[model samples]
Target: MTTYIPSLTIPSVVLQHSAASVLLPIALGTAVGFGTRPSKTQKTYLALKQPPLRPPPWVFGPVWTVLYGVMGYASHRIATIGLRSSASPAIVETAQNSLTLYTVQLGLNLAWMPLFFVAKRPSEASIDIVTLIGMNAYLAYLWSSIDEVAAWCQVPYLGWLGFATYLCVGAGYLNGWDLHDKEVKEE
Candidate 1:
């Protein structure tokens, strides 16, 4: 009788090194954003009174796609530093903390879509976005200690977060979204 053995498949270097630390977040974010972007959300967005500097809706996808790619690359670089043979204990701790915070910020990023689009709660979205901007800035500082170029790469993401924060605030105000009352009718 022949026995069948299942072999465990180990992740490739690229997958272990970059894809998990980098691409996973981007892919998850993209999937969440795309999945929640239904026609109701589109109509709500189109009907909202935008801030003065709001980019066209079409601009968001491409910009985010590029930003996500850049963010992944930056994260990959940081992860590589953590994998160094000569890495000190403190360095490893810092890298681990930075990566953990990065994941938190990514969660905050994902939270915004559902809050704004699915729940149709601009006020809540605004608050979430504000927190995201702050966390992102802190993450940038943490990444700076590990990789200067990686830190610099997050600048655009920060700028975009700032802009998104502005938009959220504007949308909340223009729509008369009461934070305390999610069921309040739009003005």
Candidate 2:
């Protein structure tokens, strides 16, 4: 006889209720982006170190919406492409490498919004952005290996990473993410 133990996970039936893998990550990612977004005050809060020069509050949602959509689709393509192709073993390693980079970048993408927007800690977000920069570079490198178009699709994402990095650094300079008692908690 053996003792039985329960698992601490959702059943497969609940874990995947649809084919919209892209939706789950995308919407949540966008929401994280949304949650971190600043109003005039937060941007003003950011003005302590340098020129605010922040975009209008209205622009954030729409721009992030489009970017999130593209990122999700690109990620879907990256995750799904090989399943449809029965390639030889020689190319499998290459595919795996590209996939690895793509996945890492995706994780970094998911991380950034929460750190910047929700936590309101640009310093932590700055740290995350460095990872984003590295991950984006790897993803781009992997993209070049697969196809020019796939690589090209990631270009805007890279630009976004760069812009976001600049914003994070500037914001951190102004607000000091380590400000207040918030630093006691893990961001």
Which candidate leads the pack in lDDT?
A: 1
Looking at model 2, report the run of 10 residues with the lowest lDDT sum.
1-10
Over 92-123, each residue of candidate 1 has an lDDT whose tens digit, in order, gives 77776776666667677888888987887887
Clashing pairs in 2: 36-117
Q: Give the TM-scores of the predictions, in the order they appear.
A: 0.82, 0.68
Model 2: per-residue Cα lDDT over 7-121, one tens digit each: 3211223212333544655677666655655453354333335435666556656776666666555544544443235754544455455555555566667776666555556
Quick one: best TM-score, which candidate? Answer: 1
Q: After superposition, how far is residue 126 of candidate 2 from its true place, in Å?
A: 0.4
Off by over 4 Å in 1: 1-16, 19-22, 178-187
